[model samples]
Target chain A: MSQFLDISGLNARIDADGQEKEILRGVDLVIPPGEVHAIMGPNGSGKSTLSYVLAGREDYEVTSGSVSFQGKDLLEMEPEERAAAGLFLAFQSPVELPGVNNANFLRTAVNAVRRARGQEELDAVNFLKTVRAAAKELGMSPDMLKRNVNVGFSGGEKKRNEVLQMTLLQPSFAILDETDSGLDVDALRIVAEGVKRLRSPQFSALVITHHQRLLEYIVPDRIHVMAKGRIIHSGGPELAQQIDREGYTKFLAEAA
Target chain B: MSAPLAVTLEPFRKQLEGVSGQPQKTALEALHHTGLPDRRVEDWKYTSLRFLAGSVFHKPGKNYDSAKARAALAALGLAEGAVAELPRLVFVNGHFVADLSVTKGLFACSFYTADKAEPGSLVRSDREPLAALNTVLAENGVVISVPEGIDAGQVLLVSLGQADSDAVSYHPRHSVHVAKGGKLSLLSVQAGEGHYLHNPVTEVFVAAEAELRHVTLQAESDAAANLSTLYAQIEERGNYDSFVVGIGAALSRHEVHACLAESFAQVHINGVQRLAQTQHGDITSVITHAAPDCISRQTVRNVLDDRARGVFQGKVLVEQIAQKTDGYQMNQALLLSGQAEIDAKPQLEIYADDVKCSHGATVGALDDDQLFYMRSRGVPEGEARQILIDAFLEEVLELIGDETAREVCKTVIARRFPVSEEGA
Candidate 1:
């Protein structure tokens, strides 16, 4: 009966040298639990800014609007606080932390979220066991756990690392920020399957992507078309097929 | 004695005369006029000892109680009876405690004692003014020698300072010699509590075909000031490696001067300096390739938080005759707070046209995107920042080679990060 995540009239801007450029203008979105929604947009369409704003990056200023996650005021929380509240963002260009080993970093992250939820921390053995299984399902090698997080990894490996984190954290709501952008065909299939395995009645996803090719594998329940910082169209999965066929030329003409 | 070398040497000589015999005291007095290193000094510009100009010096104490020394040793976490197995040497307030030193094989007492017993046999050379200061003022120090074709276990040298008086200063000296075909590992630790100053100098000589691994751990008190200088000479076909880890003291400076005197010698120097609050730490090194086909690599990492400051100055010189030399140097610093400062300068002076020499320096905070990436993975902000910091310093720490030693350094580094025990 309640919305899992509700964003109403969200506005974001970037200030470069005394000038303010609006990135998001009066954007509204809603997604209930147990549903997957995709937002498809061209380059520089403010899709990444929306994800960053929702994740509370300090650089993006939210001029006005409200985002409620699980009935909690999302904007009022720090990025870490949002994460502890079961909010996840699968970055498009996941960062490479050279010195921190993958296993140790994952364990620390998982336990941090758990402690915030008033749960006991997992011991090292138990944590390693869980990570090993999840890493295997994501097609990650054992050596990946020993290496620094994403350091020297290929583009596809970084995407898999994000999926690995999602599987480990098991967050209630996840925002996949173009996770399929640089992945190969096999990696895309594996990542889509990883998301599919995580699907549940209590879990929801806001997948930001540009291509409908990924939708063929993940199969979003609904699709939204975003242009110039606002969603102009919302429909069933058929909308994705239509965009893939006709392209954004007709939509650009209509908006004009 | 022909108008003592410098005015600063007068008080130091008078102090040494009261603690030891004639020859030793005279040798120390001979080092007098070596001008005090100031900001104007080329190598000492970034680190100035001008603050020491006004301070009065204290003489070495004669009535050091063994029981008190033993208690201090235990507090440092040395296992009981561990000293007996170690080729151990102890210094109290810059003066050597002969009763506590154990020497084996070619290892003897101080250089003066060693030379007196066998003239022209000791490896002795004069270069730095501070080395002369340590010799003249040092009442107690060590001379360690490893015979040819022998592998000596790790030798532990502990320098302890007791500041029973107000603002006392001590200069300790050491001499180490490794013969041809010999292997040696030395752990030199400087620790003390009180308002005191420690100025220590060590000279090491590695013979042809010898290998030496040296580790220096400086954990002096926050109120103490420390100046340590290490000078090593590597002969033909010798290998020398030094790892210096600094974690304490209000003001500390470590200088390592390594010279490859013969062809085909190799040197590796790695250091990590972690400072917080009002602490100041410096790692300055100069590697000279006087012979052909020499190789050298240096990596220095510094982590500064609060108002702490760190300085790294590295210089690699390839002489004209030293063709086919390979040298690489890098210095990186992580500033956790806005007030923290890091000054790093990597220098290269190469005259050999056929040599490969490169140096780089970087000073920065944690990556913003990396921080958000970790935070989005459910890691708290503090923990996320710490992970990034750890990753930044991991490259340097991984060069330690020893797993246990690396782990110990890792623990110390982790504690430096702002992580609660509950979070750990």
Candidate 2:
């Protein structure tokens, strides 16, 4: 049987200025059920591309390879199907929808997933109660729910909002791409804890980040060092500090 | 048929043979001179009157199928709701239906049959061909007067057209007058079934310090053509606030001529059109700032799909003496399909240098990033698109100050365009 989440010989490319530029040369990674994996790499290393490819983003064309999630071919699913199958991607830069109410959007998304999973949808009263408790736990103001989705939100708030959505969506496999980059120490801790709360035997995640600060709060079961569109080395959770202090220079040399 | 009839004013003029009103006689003479406008006319550039060609629109008879009218009302959610409780003026086939109407309200209301109808003073029939057509063939109408210092709550003016095998057309002439210090809100709903033409002309006179909130919901039959014209004259400190929502018709155009005749008056002409299939919708307005300190604001939005076409033409003319006139106009369109089209023309003629006038337009499709973001969160592509569309129109709907009117428009739009069940 395939692993809980698996990627083998994955290659992807994007069209930039009418020219095809390969982003993911050959990415191979795996994570068993209930385990958290961290992929730390410098800029231009195709770290985010791996997350996008897994989320079924249409911009990137996967030339070769296979991705299996829970015994299903993940790449064959649409983005929404991926979501309904318990996959979520925390964007590096959250999009702003000017006139969509934050609370309403959250409810619609949550109910959409629930409906697909054959779960009874939550009504307005229950949804408001659940979302209110979630927001308060994230230290978010009530007014944020009334405003447009992510419009005019601060960087920290946008990140927290992403976490809010991740918490509400309750995805089985989440790919958080630099979700802690613009966050402060307190916000980073809250977001990490939000993810930690979802850690269980049924849950798995891939945390992609530049700094090791986030890993300190939500330490991973394994850490992989990626360079030039490939994961070159991996080890236990201790590898995060090694790469954090010494940087990817050693990994780049070793991969070369 | 003996030699296919030419598409001209001949059919319409033939009906005017025994028309006794002097205004009708004069309007017929004008029609003989100018004829119907084609695409060559600057105002009629984007819209075509060729839809009026083959079908000979006969004057609607007095009787109508009440069941069909009831079904139409049910479609609008007006059969039972807060809106149904309001005082209503019901007209079927252009003739007033007393049993179906409830006219007990705070205002003085009267009806005019085609022969006894007195054309209002506001229309310039010589210049506008449709207005001239309405003057000659208007069969039924409503005359509403709000007394001074009285706040008339709300009134419903409904026109439902039901045409059978023989295509029928009706021109309903309506006039609204608000005395000094009076306040009124008018919600006009136009709906119909089958092949027909609905051409209505309304004259509004707002006395000094009075207010008239007019909202029109044009949900015509898919096979019909709708041509409606409105004229409003606002005196000192008076307010003429109007909004038109167009979601139906094979071809439709809503034209408004508003004049701020005195200082400090305000006029707002805001509207939205949601068209699909091969539908065509147009909104054209001319606001004349005749006195200093008058304010004119207009915002129109269009959502088109399939091979639909949308048009917006707004002209703001500020007179030489109208200094400090604050005028703003904006038109935007969201094309949901590759074949959809939108034509926007914003004109500003300011003779006074001290006036402040601005106009802008934007056309675009739904942002892919926004769609992806929503889909990434488990919302299906179709539902995500619908959410974004509602968000796009929510900003404009919020501008409607009257709660009931806004709710009615929202209900109508939601019923007309529900969430798509299939994914993209």
Candidate 3:
């Protein structure tokens, strides 16, 4: 396989005041199948920008680069198409859809993906049963399923809801962008557990975080250090500990 | 009393001139005094019935093939009418269709055939010229009366318009009265085909301690015009609750004039209108708190697509003597197309010092963030848009206390939306 996810010479810019400002400068990275990779970076290091680009957010312009998922061009697909193609992005802050029933929203997403993947659609009763079970495993209340999607949900609840969606979608590759932020320790552990449960030879993940706090619960196979819109270092899990102990001072000095 | 008549309105004036009864003459005189309200008139500023001046609507004599009428009736999903278990009183083109009708609670043949005109017990005609015109022309209608201290289960009235090549108009005058401590729930469904104008003026009376739940739906053919008006009067401790749904017609307006005539009476005017394409809809209400401690509430929602336009003009009048009055009204519109338009006017005329009255109107397009969120979740843009629109309408539906009636309201709203599904 030509690199499960191949990103080469990725150059991106964001629009600010009718002007394009470079964010990602000639960055290159790759994640093979079944490997969990963590990208640890400080603020303004373009960690979030990379996740947003991979998720196909329209605000950012990709000046130059090629992204391949399973040998298929990923840049040409819409956000929903990317989702249907097994690319899921766990948002740091889940959107609140007032008046949209949580169960209804979840069912619509599930059925849509199933139809795209040619899987048999689940009926309402079966859907409820499955969702109830999954929700219980995540320590969620039945009322959460009855309320509107993410409306008035607490910070922890929103994070857990994101995890619930990831578990339900079961994407081949997931980009968890700071899902550990705004989450309590217990919630962080539970969310990490949810991601760990999906670990398999067929699944891989790109976890982006500013702190190494999340890597503690879900150990990563590889750790990458990013600074000033570029990955400056790559090593084993020990790199996470090193960064936690010394901070990005040494890395920034070296990159400069 | 006729206002200056245009060339088109002369015929109505002549027709009114021929009728001599005081009520009919008074109505005709008023029509003559006001002629047909044009742009100059305050109430008729947004909607112009000026076409009715030039247009001639033939009497309901052109009977069509029963099959088309049956199809129109079937498509209405009358089973969702809530009171489906109750026998339905069917009216076709302002004339009762006995073959397809069975009525319970209270029914009178005179109201259907115009064979007689009994003195109307509850007449609170507003100053609108259309109200006066309806008085002179109204012949087909229904009259229901509940005895004192009795609870009548429910009653349904269905009016179907059979398509005809020639344009026509008819006024169905419905009069209902609930005596002291009486209860009544009335469901009215108005649907039709072809180029026609359905003007229905329903007058309801609720005695002290009585309650009336009135739900009216106007889903006429896209080619037709519907101008429906409701007049309600409430006494001490009486409640007049109503919900009106406007979904069809090229030009339509659901107008209401409710007066709380006694202390402690309450009135609720909640409704929803969905219009698409070149259609135009208006929901106008004028509620008056004439007694102390009376309350009134109004909530209306509109979903517009294409070049469709919706108008809301609601006014709450708290009389100087009516202290402790509580009145509230809110109107919201969702524009689904760039060309769609909504005009909202909330007028609050409160004279009481110790009263609580509030009114608000909002107009906006589909939220961009909400749309992106749903689409990001894998819902196609069209379906996601439909979901948000549906959700936006639920807040108004929740105001409906009757479960079955709420379902009926939602069903009508849904059937009217996704307009492409119907045209395609």
Question: What TM-score would chain B of candidate 3 score versus the native chain B?
Answer: 0.92
Q: Which consecutive 10 residues in model 1 chain A have the weakest lDDT in total? A: A1-10
Maximum-DockQ candidate? 2
TM-score per prediction, in order, is 0.91, 0.97, 0.93
Q: Candidate 3 docking: what grade?
A: medium
Better of 1 and 3 by lDDT: 3
Q: lDDT of each structure?
A: 0.79, 0.91, 0.82
C-alpha lDDT of residue B18 in model 1 = 44
Give the alpha carbon lDDT tens digit for every residue of A1-256 in model 3.
Answer: 2999999889999999998899999888999999999999888989988988997878889999899999888889877778778888888778888889999999998887888888998899999998998998888999999999999999889888888888888799999989999988888888999999999999999999877889999899999999889999899999998999999899889888
Ranking by lDDT: 2, 3, 1
Off by over 4 Å in 2: B1-7, B10-13
List residue ranges in candidate 1 displaced over 4 A: A253-256, B1-34, B62-77, B80-87, B95-127, B411-424
Cα displacement (angstroms), candidate 1, residue B415, comes to 5.0
lDDT (Cα, tens digit) per residue for candidate 2, span A1-256? 3699989999999999999999998999999999999999889989999998998889999999999999999999989999999999999999999999999999999999999999999999999999999999998999999989999999999998999999999999999999999899999998998999999999999999998889999999999998889999999999988987798888888889
How accurately is candidate 3 docked according to DockQ?
0.65
Query: At residue A89, what lDDT does model 3 achieve?
Result: 85
Let me know the DockQ for model 1: 0.78
